[model samples]
Target: MANKTLVPQAKAGLNKFKMEAAKEVGVNLTDGYNGDLTSRQNGSVGGQMVKKMVEQYENNL
Candidate 1:
């Protein structure tokens, strides 16, 4: 079976969010495909996104 998003409609927004996070963390992410990035660089971008999400959640609480 294939995995699916809980909210499929938000996919586009999430992609945009990821791109913004990459830019903020100094990772050069391009549109379309980005399978060439190093693990460290990708991990940094993901980490920054989680950090920002947590901060936003806390602020809203």
Candidate 2:
């Protein structure tokens, strides 16, 4: 299957979550577009978001 989000309706929420994750990880993020950011900076933000999500899931379990 083509890669796509399961919950397309949650795109806005996910964007908000991403911004929060970026802030928490000290990555400067802005709305609209962010193509100026370096790959490492973007990767760290994603990594931090995944780490936080996993922690939250484990805590709930």
Candidate 3:
């Protein structure tokens, strides 16, 4: 049997914060398995979360 090592398909596609945000929103983003999420969709989910967080933070300031 051949050994198969799992790896992230796109290392530079998303950052730690984005990954965490995806988890918060219930996205199944594993280290070696992101499933079928497109680049744009993944980016949007993270970006939108950041935008919302920033707005909320600014409102409190």
Q: At residue 40, what lDDT does model 1 achieve?
A: 96
Model 2: per-residue lDDT, tens digit, 1-61? 9968789998899989999999998988999789999999999999989999999999999
Best by TM-score: 1
Cα lDDT tens digits for candidate 3, 1-61: 7643355664454456567777776676766767588887687777767786899899999
**TM-score for each model:** 0.86, 0.85, 0.45
Error of 3 at 4 (Å): 24
lDDT of 1: 0.93
Q: Poorest 10 consecutive residues of model 1 by lDDT?
A: 1-10
Order of candidate numbers by lDDT, starting with the best: 2, 1, 3
Between 1 and 3, whose lDDT is larger? 1
Model 1, span 1-61: residue lDDT tens:
6767679999889889999999999999998678999999999999999999999999999
User: Per the 3 Å backbone cut-off, how many clashing residue pairs does candidate 2 have?
Assistant: 0
**Candidate 3 minimal-lDDT segment of 10 residues:** 3-12
Off by over 4 Å in 3: 1-34
